[model samples]
Target: MLKTIFPAALILCLSAPVLRAQDLPDYVGSGQCAACHEAESQSWQGSHHQLAWTEPTADTVVADFDGTRFQNDDLTVAFSKDAAGYHAQITESDGTTTMRRVHSVAGIEPLQQYLFETEPGRLQSFDVVWDSEEKRWYHLYPDQSLPVGDGLHWAGPYKNWNARCAECHATGYEKNYDPATRSYASTQAEIGVGCEACHGPGSAHIDWAETGKPVEIPGVDAFGLTMRSTADSEGWIQQCAGCHSRREAFGDGNPVPGTPYHDAYRLMMLTPDLYFPDGQIREEVYVYGSFLQSKMYANGVSCMNCHNPHTAQLVAEGNAVCTQCHSEAGNTEFPSLPIADYDTPEHHFHEPGSEGAQCKNCHMPTQTYMGVDARADHSFRIPRPDLTPITGAPDACTNCHQDQTPEWAAQQIEAWYPDSDKRGPHFGTVFAQSAVDPAGALPDLLKIAGDEGQSDIARATAMYLMGAAADQQTARATAPLLRDDSPLLRAAAIRPQRAAPPQEQFQNLLDLLSDPIRLVRLSAAPDLLRAPVASLPPRIAERFGRVAGEWQRSLGNRLDFPETHLVLGGTALTMRNTPAAIGAFREAVTQDPQLLDAWVMLVRLEASVNGAEAANAVVEEALQANPGQPDLMAMQRELQQ
Candidate 1:
């Protein structure tokens, strides 16, 4: 029954509008939660989660709507409010004016961004943001130029709320995306991240509450409607990280709060694009990715330890937050851990009231995103003044003392902790070096991967980076990790298998097809499917078909994005389904006209079927939209020859 229901539910998620919480569903809405836990509900009222997504109204909308003009280069966006609703006239680079209706708002305080419904069930976050504190409008990416037709454009698939932003912002969001129509009827239990979003669906709990029944067993502390785990378990952390971490959802739909993270999404490691090689926040990755790397996490520090789950505010202000666990007395739960005097000048090397005196100032630091939004690095670590000079990652010492040099900070650090273990050469130095020169860093990364002392994440990242220079030596080194205890490590190890022959790959990925982790099994599906299934044993072929179907469904769930279509096209090409490949490529270009590779592939496929004239016309149309695009130009030149 469960197996039959799961696939039927998937079809329902694909075709139907989402079921409301009130419709006898497990999710009974935050209002129901407020009836019993008013204190928690009230504390969460105006928190960031509550305001993550709010209906656009005179009260909710923070941006100026009184004919305010924000100019970026030649393009001008004029924001105004009227009886119809808040609207904006956006003039494009190529002298085209578009009227965008303000559908909803995202964020508050530091900055508020408006969302425009560019297409049905698709919300595009406006490029311009309102600086609520400064009382001014500014371009979110003032330094970067994203042209009108590009995928990164405000109207493009990258900014679509249905595919990218909605799940995190809303409660019980069902991204009802139709692969057939490329539309969404996406619905949520509540507009914002409500109580049910964390505590799980409430109907069952409410039933037990009214009847005075036991919601917990002798050892288990699970609520009747909550996830099937207790506070003591890692269930809550996994739930929070579902949205908080930088991850890729496999279109599993809205998950129950207690669902294992690997079952729903593929957690991204400390990749170079998102994090500095030294593991400081480089991009706007929210928080959980870095938090996973912290010693606090290693010592059982969950989000609730520092933050109020209700208000989402720090449990204490200033250094007091750090002092909770980092004091000489230390936390009773973690007595074996070393403690420090974080607030004093001896520890911080600054006056008590100075910015450098703060624990986070030296350790967490910050990176600014959305112009005014500054997020702290959650990977709490000791101030690496030692690595600043080596890796060029910002040290807390140099950040506050802008006048002082990194060498001076290093001198002062060495003077205090002359025999400090922290003063030694770090793996981050190796990680940073690899990003710039993979050939030089591969040997060092291999050493990091083999070392048992290093954290699993660090070792996993090392194995991942080997893809840059996946030579025979690197492949040999990574082969051992294919059977590592950590699934994250095994996933990295499988990267080198791309260099092997089809028969070898079939054998290599066969065991992984039945791996416990969904991430490993699905990742292996495409590779195993690359070889002809007829060549394999009947049972193995059956497993391949089942896994491949699930994998393709996951891809189809994200069909609103052109990149997913590109993946589908590649998969179709492997199976020699030329029509399917052409259709997938066509869908890719339809969603994102400036998707260069999709157009090139479409042209190549079209040339084989409809001759060069048809392919030339396709290239000509693409060239008109994206003038002087090097890849498309090269394709056109090749076709002419």
Candidate 2:
């Protein structure tokens, strides 16, 4: 269990600061932006991005708070509105009632979630939400019976608005979390995602405007914006992906707008829990990760090509959005695209007016999330029922055909296009095969890692999955990819090298300690720490210190997260700091009592350093938090003996 959990902790540390309003001198509000760009600002009004978060008001609070009572199983919540504001009285299974005043509201269309100040400086998103379409209240997770202590409960850390949601919802947000006191002094420049959220701070641009708006040379930012107008497709895409993608942020709140995505956050790759093996959305992965795997993204397509930046809506309705490039009269913007008619029934194999004939229904299947919202896949992939059996990933055909098997769908695909070349082996086959048979799938995984034709994300994911089977042979095979041009591949390639000899590890990671990308250098710093830094040359030691400081700061930014404490505890244990490890483990379990491994580690350390009585006391606390656990029970019995 230690081996399995420790490696993950290292990765988490590699993967994962505060500001005040007065600290941000460059951020001019969106109201200032509207003065120069009225048309864009007006278009943005009432859009989801504009209303992502707002204070509770008569206009904003749409839920029925006229003393309405909503009961679910043993829990009953009464919502009421007074001159003060919207409020909820929640009665638990134990019949204890607590009154909570709504501090803010999130979203507007399909559903709206209320946020309550559960603790001083800590805002939590309530589970019960209002369905705008149905005009009724409902629980977001109707299936689960999450009690007060459960992490999934509304008041838990996972539901923290400041830590989890505020960065994306509000512009120029800073989650000022003080770890010593375990509290937040959060601040934001504005209530919602405004002009500066994507375009960066506007003070410089305002200066540019007030000083007669001097014209500058081409490629120079005349407007003084962080996101340059001359930015290419990839640069523009990263701007949107900074907030849209499901990723682990590196620092406090969101990074400055227009910062490189890799520098700000670690993009989650195609992992089994978050995505299907075929790179379809399995969880709420948002758009960026799936888009990275698409041919559209490969051909220089970006978010703005389909979505209006200001309005956050599709550029065109239905098939017109796709046919701009896919149709017989191809778009001039993409001269390389092959002209083809994809919206016809002959291509989709359905009646022209039917739902099956829709381009999105096949290429971008919708997955329902939050019970009411349905988000379409952005991969823009062709329907390949043939690969479903091999990958165990859902196909577009069988997803809609409730009674049909994947084999049936594959047969139909074969009957329609017998000579098609789309049935060739995909990387998904190798990824899925790796799960059940790592040794057998390793050769193919290495091949995929080296395949330049595949997306860098896919190659990086292949390298990440190969960590389970790390050995000298696997490390040697993947060594060439360590110097790959892509930062993602460079970062992932370091994981497998853990199997190499100590001298080999030192030699291989020395250059990466000063790698151009911060993420890559941070990735190498942990593995390089195993070597004695003081014994190294002066220049090399300095490089290690700089990168190690970056790694430490990255961990410091995420101290609010319970798992970050777990990583701290693991790092302390590795450095032979027993007391520090004990403190970290204690903090981890205190923040999240359900953290079983932290409790176990804490008990072990207490028993060694203190006494069996101290360990027994911890065991009793662990049993109270997680009752009837075999490991804790066994530990308790041993301590008694």
Candidate 3:
């Protein structure tokens, strides 16, 4: 029998009645393993993974509840603890002070967020947060006073714990959302990320440990879990990207541990929405996408090499973690890495033991999100200070030396190493120039997209930008990528065929309708929708309609955000369902009143369906909120005439 160490605190937290895997379902609670795998379980005790989310008990609750009132802009929130539980008095956008009970606590250390169940299975994390280190309550968006009905509001869908946060925070979490009913029957085997969250369902593994019988579940590994599915480094990294990367999931999204990333979720590329042109972290990209761009990733580096997965901590603290592999003599594991004194002033250009001497300071720059959450970029690119003014991407040099300009930083680097290959023209400058004038940068983008020497992700992103102002040349540049093995490139190639005739585009994109990846199939939907359906063979048209329906359903499933509804409205227009388009546009403006495009579409729809009078009313309404808007003003003049 494996001796398991169960701390008194861990035992108390695990006292809740759970749905045992053997009795009712697949997930055995994490607590069930304490008697067997003691060391691993004990090692995980009090880890960030273990405490990501917890029931708001006295010991677990780190915030002060001594009737403290914190004011953020116009709103004043009062936190108090009663006999029943911890509660907050929050003033709504409509000026109603409502009492909300704290249902659960999320995060620890620098900050802690409280979850409130506004409705059954519709839990929302209140915007007001407790800064544990500061010992004070502060709004998550201290500077921005978002109104109550806004999606970014604490009570709105964006902050909903089930859809946004639950998947990663808990084990065996089934969102179980019903789009038809607008409700959630959300269930989790154990609250907070647990043993099964990473290792997969533990019933067969536990049985094997106790009875010395290996469960012969097909596809199950020797540990009796569906893990270690592939021996390659990329396959293992997919296990981490499932949660770590910002992505869109397909189907039920109940991905088993080690499920192939494409089989489970569509990993987002370096889209302009998430990252800067240079592939530096510009938003709340957790880490995976940035890490994929690193030279380290190219040379066979992995998360497990530097961090312990169980404890969720660095394997070694400070610079020592990096020195293990990046020593003076490049190890056999990384024969390509040149021999260099990484720790000395020769490489770092900083005094030994200074903040700038840290490997991460020079390589992995930091970007802050969610107010207090500062995460370091994992791309590990050498700082190109020269690209700062050109591309608007932050460089590591100016990040530390706030007063100095990027020009000065670049000059200093050139001064330090006159012949250093690190200081060279980079993709950042190209991406920045492309964003400003896509026509001007088309040649560079084409070169980057076709070159195998460049990062495939950067290549794919260039193809994505190619969709704007695409010509015959752009089509020629991207046509071959449709059959590329990488789905990212395959999906991106479909968008840049503007000059090609509709039939030609349909012909090029037809086979991708049957592409194995859901994202690839979905990407082909719009172009296929333009097919001469009446002229196609009966069987081909049927298949086309089927794929189109699947793509529409995929769009419908993600109507939680205004962005999705915006897409829904555009798709509806393409399908020639004017009423559906109108409804979707209305929903979008309801979520975000300032969405000028939605309002413009509404005006266009009203003019077509009803009359100029109806269109004029919408235009006037848009101008009231967004006065002097050129598009609306133009419409108003046309309607008046």
- Candidate number of the best lDDT: 2
Error of 3 at 163 (Å): 2.1
**lDDT of each residue in 1-641, candidate 2, tens digit only:** 22222243343343222332333337888899887899999999988999899989998988999999899896899999998899999998668899999999998989999999988999999989999999999988888877788666788888899988999999888887878788999988898899888887777677788896843533227777767767888888999998889988877776777678887888898999988888889999989999999999989998989999899899999888989889999999888899989888768889896888888998999899998999999998888887888887888998889799988988988888889888887999999988888878889989999889999989999988887687888888888878988888999899888888777877887899768887888788778766543366668666766676678778877877888888788777776668778878888887788889999999899899889999999999999988898999999999999
Any residue pairs clashing in model 3, and if so which?
4-38
TM-score of 1: 0.90
Local accuracy of candidate 1 as per-residue lDDT tens digits, 399-486 = 8779999889888888988888886667899988887888888889889988877777788888778675867667666777788887
Model 2, which residues run further than 4 Å from truth? 1-25, 213-220, 532-534
Off by over 4 Å in 1: 1-25, 82-84, 144-147, 214-222, 436-440, 471-476, 500-504, 532-534, 606-615
Model 1 error, position 629 (Å): 2.1
Q: After best superposition, candidate 1 residue 343: deviation in angstroms? A: 1.6
What C-alpha lDDT do the candidate models reach, one value each?
0.78, 0.84, 0.77
Cand. 2 TM to true fold: 0.94
Model 3 error, position 539 (Å) = 4.8
lDDT of 3 by residue, 1-641 (tens): 00011111211111122222233226888888888878989988888889999999898899998788987566888889978999999886568898989999998867899999998878999888888877877777777767766556777777888878888888877676665466888888888888888777888787778888757776567667766534467776777787888888654334677667775666677767789988998888888888878888878888888888778899998998888877786577878877766878878889899999999998888888777778999998888897888888888999999999999999998898889887666777778777778888888888888877777678878887765667887886688999998887888788786557766777888899789887788788766665554456667666776666666555544555566667767766765668778988987777666688999999999999999999999998887767698988998999999
Which residue pairs does candidate 1 place in steric collision?
A: none
**Candidate 2, residue 231: lDDT:** 81
lDDT winner between 2 and 3, please give it. Answer: 2
Q: How big is the positional error of residue 231 in model 2, measured in Å on the Cα after superposition?
A: 1.3
